[model samples]
Target: NLSVVVIDEAHHYVGSLGASFQGLLWRLERLARHYHARPVIIAASGTIANPREHLQTLTNQAFVVVDDSGASQSERTILFWDCTRDPKTPPSTQAAYLTRHLIRMRRSVVVFSNTRAQAEYVAMAGSDRSHRILPYRSGYSAEMRRRVEHELRSGSIRGVSATSALELGVDIGSLDTVVLNGYPGSISSLWQRLGRAGRTDLDALGIVMVGGDPISRSLLANAAELLERTPEHAIAASDDTDILTRHLLLAAAELPLEETSIEDGPGATAALSDLVNRDLLIKDGTTYRSTKQRPHLGTPFMEREASYEIHFQGTRDHRAVERISIRQALREAHKGAVFLHFGTPFRVQRVDSERREIVCIPETEGHHTQPALFRSLSQGRILEHLEPHPTLGIERIEALVVEQVTGYKEFDQQGRQVAKRKVTSPIISSPAEAVVLTCVDPIYLGIDPEDLFAGLHALEHALAKVLPLLTNGGTSDLASLTLRNGDAPSIVIYYLTKSHPSTMITKVIHNLHEALSLAEHLIAACSCASGCPFCVLDARCDDEVIDKGAALALSRLLGKISVGTALDSSGDEEG
Candidate 1:
């Protein structure tokens, strides 16, 4: 019956966050509701452009305004050094530089890297610092991570580099600073990590190192917009039947979860029992359990260890528990070294692959080595223009593109190794499915020849914000591609999810006709046989952009479209 909840990374579990953000969320909500608990959440996510309506719908409750706190310190001080001229400003180098810089100023620091390998690299480089550098993340044996935390608390560590595991409130000790190596990719992430700083008796210092991307540029530009803007808010999820169904089976593993019991959310207990009527659950006595197969917690990503165990000279203690990953292990121990464990400067002589241990000895030299791969970011150039060629199509004139990615590839898709692509991005413009509504003029800002690419980048930023809403309901894939005519250009979104385009075909057709009806009043050129930007669209459009004005008219014409989904069916879907 816990009414209060704190949902960290709420955005990650939405219907359309990842390939299956919705599926995971449905499971979470189903579990909560089954126990007669509804969370009034203090939810967290990256920057939220819209908070009020988002949270109200997300949590399924009438939510009132709470403290919309500004970022604890300066709006957000982002520094972009010109690294293209010198590739030495790699994540690892910059991480070490930030730590040393802070330590020089007598401040404690945390380095947030995008991956575990990078975190370990940074930690290894700073091994000799008196405030020992600690590598923290989810993958290390619970024993190892706990030991790391203990050293941090004792001020035996100067810096702790980590993955997202440290992003939450796992306070090892208060630090004077935090250095974000890359954009954490969301508003909630930025603020939550920033919260790690300013925790000391002294005012904390915060620094964010930017990766080269349009999103990163936008964040750097509007560093203070949130100062006058509302605080980032959260969005919750509705119940999902798939999750409920899964829980129905798992509930049997604990105690019989009977239909008509008072444990389910709202009217869920009775609703769940309908499955028994359908023979999904078998009723015995007053309780009902799954008629299906057994529940599998499955194997964890790595060797599962005690969540909070630390061994010190054969003695052990416990700390926070979390999932371990390959990324976390590499990030924490890549440049494995031995520092003073109990008075002696330990040496990590070599890493044993099979044992997952770094062979170490007392340090023979003054310095330990953590190799860094330098990548450049501060290649911030102004946008020139867009030129179209029939062969290459539309190309960006000037933009900040990833020139050469020099790290080990972690995830590979379509044969391109992830995080290793020498990605090049132009001030790109693509088309999105539009609604024909002219009620509000779409906001357009002038692009200086130099800033044209930046404008395109800002749109890229805006599109990311808008696209998440459409695909987030959970059952789908979200992607986009570029669409350009001989003269015009736009983006074509391929949103494949639970949303079926076939279902709304009729209303879409009617709205298109309404758009055609308005072409005469809107413009005569729209009716011309020759190609013109303004016109009514049919099904097979090269650039599938629906006019917003025409769309709103159609929306008013269609009224509210309700999708009734039963969350009590938790049976998982087959591919």
Candidate 2:
């Protein structure tokens, strides 16, 4: 009998999906009680906050947490090297150059790239300079990966470029350096990758080479914030209706759940009745049980990480191809686009959305593809409204978002636009649970109506790039919409997560004063004069060019209101 269960890398299990291992742990707890055997759980994560609460929620048990480390530590050196956007050389090329230099200095190194293709490119470039470096990613066979790890530890290989697949706690002996090709989306992930070096308490170096993206550039400028942040709390949607229904059905199948015995949230009377209507369960007065036709819930009790399979020739050989998330496939796998698998390039022939698959063939083209997207947000009904500040209005809303990949733009090695091709694909729509914030009377703050609109647009773009820093969600995981309210002169801002009905990120932003403070701090601290990429400029904006000065003016105006504004002599506003 299993008496203990240990989960490593616990942060990976936290996701927006309603389903999670919590249900399975609940079942295990029930079974253990029936058998009179207690199970002890130990979950370890390098970047998890609220460990005690997270553990209790996952296992339905009360336990003490021992978080302090007993191991000794040494001082580590972290360096941030900011590069110009649209640099003459790509970030990958720079990463390769640095890795080669470190290897020549006889320092063992691991370079972390965001994508497999990037990992491959970095590895290849480093190898051109020095032959002792190699690529290490997920696509390689287990034996091959083991061999590479052995070589890295044995000093046969001086450096290895990798993706997040190698970011976990894998033993590779003592190392001297770690290189980050780009910001890894979250402070937790950044620290975890850096922790891979200096394991032995030996002095080590961690280099962060910022990329051209807004997130990287923002982080590059605010390097101290990255190092000073506490890890984000890991959240699981245990009370999600869809997830609860599935688990409740499984609980009934497990051992005939007594209605009064289970917890109130997921196992309430109304939930059971709803399941009865679906024919998945039967209620016999006070007790409920599973149907005889199917007594087991085959869908595993874990967060569902769904992916679309890429078919080389309609064969299911996992080794020959890679799987990408459905969201990514929709955005990047449209016809005429280039797909990169483990750093190898392929041209997409077709995308079968119905089958959740993409068909592609080898490509000899020396260009990368970028999707040109058309997106819109339908008006939503307000479920909850709040006036956090006299000038700020907040609302919880339900809306629909449609994204269409209208075409793609190709770029060559020189960062020059090569070709633009149109794609005739159906629009992808999804329900959006959002929080809307409306700012009042921008014209009274000494800004013209046209500039007000441009300013709002620029603020929305900047918030979309900056919100990721304050929350666990990445920039891709969040979407926003900004426009002047048709019925009123106020500007409305909507922030939506691609997952979950409600998110802590939105809850945090509901504090208008805090949100405005962060926005003002970001803009005021940036050195860019007219909104370059490091400030408010958005390369992905399809509407119009943003007015940087107007954006700064609007931000300052909001800040004034948040800080208690008063009417000035001209009847404008002063704080």
Candidate 3:
């Protein structure tokens, strides 16, 4: 019999992970009811702003939060290293140099990167004869991860570059220094990563290398405000249709689900009916049973589309290197792309869609590949609309997004474009949820038509980078598209996931006014005479259309609109 359930690192209970865990808790409660036993849940979180509320949302039960710590405290020093001050060297290069310096000081250090590719790049760049820094991320093989863990514990490796995968409560011995390559999405995450060092009573040092993103740059300018700001709230929609559907299937397989056992929400009822219609569930005497054996086997905790297996082509036999999601495979493991694993480069030879496998050969060349993508969005139904200001209108819509990988560009070891080749790949199209921003008239900004479009493009780029900081989501979680509807220009900020309801987008809509204000500050704070990667320009943007002055003008015009004001009450001319 279960009496107490302890959830460690409870802040991770957000997004799909939180939804899956919530479903498990629901089942556990049902089982306990059958046995007439009640279990007390104790959730422990370090850096959540609303710990009690977050846990309640996760488990559907009330919690009494104990915020104070009883353990001994360690003296820690957090130093902010602004990368904008030193623009001559790249941020990654500076990170590698700092990692090497920290290792030379005989202090064990962990350098945290925002992405897996950046981790690998830092590890490869920081490796020297005296010490070899390795990359640790989610896509690596379990065996390789275990080996790295063992090495780190035994002090065999003094330094490592990793993504947020290492920020959790993993036992990887004690660390002396923590280097943040960039601001990790939110304040809670930033503090969580900094807490990785000095687990014991030993004094620790944390270095944050601010990147060129709008959020990071803003934090750099207002360091005091950032330090004093409260952490963002964590959110998870347990009643989301796609998430609920998967969990309901798993619950039915665990024990026959009755009307009394499940919540009678519209989404739940529709999911149940859809399952029965698809022959995945059988209805018998007011109960539903899964037709398939162990339905949980097919459902993963994390929501993802199809996946592709990467295999190393050895002389004698092929060996599985790692498995990657289909989206990542399209961008990184496309045909003729150079894939890096454990600091070793592999050139992809073939991407077999039928077999769902990517075969690669070890490459001795020093080059990288980046895919060129084209994205388009079709008309969608508006679910809600709000006009915060007379000139600005925001709408939540459901639409279909089509993404195509047109070709790839090859870059040499010196970060110079060496060649560009076209490749034939399947188009990816799926349903998405988006928040569209429309202006009453583009003429209000008094900018040329060409520059108006360019400013809109720049604003979209800046918003995509800045919204992640406010939404508690990553840059990959949201995407932006600019559209011109006659004289009015609209920017569509949509989720990257397919057919899923995300609280992140909801937060974006609620905080759209704040986001615009931040964007305006970011554009004005930038020292560049025109647009640059540090402000409005995106490094990933292949198009060369961007205008900083025009974007600033448009942003100022939009920011003037009062939030929460009704469109009818504004008494302004509409487009």
Candidate 4:
């Protein structure tokens, strides 16, 4: 019988975190029932905003969340380091400079980078110091990582640079400073990384070095939300049909399920019946057992691995395993593409989609590879519509996006494109739910048809950059699409999660007035003149389709649109 189970870094149990934990938890729950020993589950995370709700959904059990550790919080200072002051220098360079300064000041610091390459770069840049400053990342051996941790604790290592691999509580001792090379994407991770410093009532300092990305620039401009707003809530959709079936089958294999079995929850009855129909299970009286003594059942709860094993030439020992999703593999693992593994470069030789692996060899030629993708909206349907004004309407839509990685470009260290190649691949489809806004009569607002498309497209791009403020998702979790519906210009923003729609994002969309107001504020607050990446132009948008003046006008118009009539209509309809 299981007495206790502890899940650490619990926030990662959802989304991209694959199914091993689900299988383990299912077995433990059954064991507790059979042995009459109820094991206590202690799920731990330092950053989740809604622990109680997230735990209930993850484990299908209620929990009494204990957020109070009784440890008083230490005073902390957060600084936004705007790299725009010196546009010629990269954020990594600035971070390296800041790290060196902190080391000189005798402050124990940990610098966090979003990628392994940046981590190594920072560590290398700061190696000039006399004290021990080292690079720590997942690629390092366990013993090596342990040595670094030990050195840091023993006061031998003065500073360390690392990726998110060190974000969890790894007992590195208290730090005096944290330098973020880029926005950690989510506020949860931002705070968690900062928590590494200032432990045990010691005052600490946190610095965010603005990267080239638009999201980082936006956050740097409006720094208040990063510090004052509540961190995004972590939500899980554990009612996945495939996951449930796998757990039920495992339970049936473990013990015969009877009518009164605890395994027979609300949906378990239907699942078992389906299995019996499929001949995977047999019914004897009221009990169910596996039809095949050794059923070829696979673990379905964990994420499937469609990854490439990068091994050193002439050696069977694998250097690293780059676990990528099917969609990411298609885009990132094409032949001739350059892939960076733990800050080291490798060029793809072949991609065997059937084997679910990419074959790559080391490349001494230093350059970064970026995939050029083409996307089209396959189909769309309006599920609901709220006309906020005579010319403005908000629509809830279900859409399918078809995308393909057609080619890739290589950029040298000087940021100049040097090579380009095209590849043939099957299209990838993503079905999503979207919130679309339509402007029926743009000319009525003194905007031309061409200007309307450009303006709305620009608005769509800008809104997506800031959507993470409303949900537990990052910029990658959502996308924006702009298109023309007959004569009207329309823009759609949608979530990418397949399990369940993010209610937080949808709620913000439902209140279009507030969303538009916030979107306009972001565009207006940008320091760039006549629209730059910081304001209107998104990396996804076509330069031909983005106009800063028109976008600002469109944002202003959207903000002024009166939803009073729609509110009254909705109220009367409810009545």
Each candidate structure's TM-score, on Cα atoms with residue i matched to residue i, is 0.49, 0.73, 0.77, 0.68
Best by TM-score: 3
| Candidate 3 segments whose C-alpha is farther than 4 A from its true place | 69-72, 84-88, 211-216, 256-302, 314-320, 369-373, 378-400, 404-426, 433-440, 444-479, 484-488, 495-575
Error in Å for residue 143 of model 3: 1.3
Write down the TM-score for model 1: 0.49
Q: How many pairs in model 4 have backbone atoms within 3 A of each other, for residues 3 or more apart or on separate chains, i.e. clashes?
A: 5
lDDT of 2 by residue, 500-557 (tens): 4545434435444556666767777776655644457554455664676777777777
Candidate 2 has a TM-score of 0.73
RMSD to the true structure for each prediction, in A, is 14.4, 7.6, 6.2, 7.6
Task: Report lDDT per candidate.
Answer: 0.42, 0.68, 0.77, 0.70
**Candidate 1 lDDT by residue in tens digits, 314-426:** 21222322232222223222333322232223433454445444444445443323222332112122111121112111111111212221233322111122343222211
Residue 457 displacement in candidate 2 (angstroms): 5.7
> Candidate 3: worst 10 consecutive residues by lDDT?
566-575
Top-down TM-score ranking:
3, 2, 4, 1
- Give the per-residue lDDT digits (tens) of candidate 3, residues 31-96: 787788899998778687889988897888888977665644489898889876777666776898
What are the clashing pairs of model 3? none
Residues 1-575 of candidate 4 have per-residue lDDT tens digits of 56788988877665323233555576678768788998888888778788777777667688998877565578899999988787776677678778888988999999999876567656765667385568787646677788889889888877999988898758565688999988776678889898888876678999988865655656766788567756666644343344556666767777886756645465567777788999888889988887665453554445443444444342245655545566666666677777655445677787776676777787777666778888766546555656767788776666676888899888664345788988886677776777778889898888997788888888877776555544434355567788777688688777554544444335446456766777788788866655554567664454446776788788889889764432222222210
Candidate 4 has an lDDT of 0.70
Choose 1 or 2, whichever is better by lDDT: 2
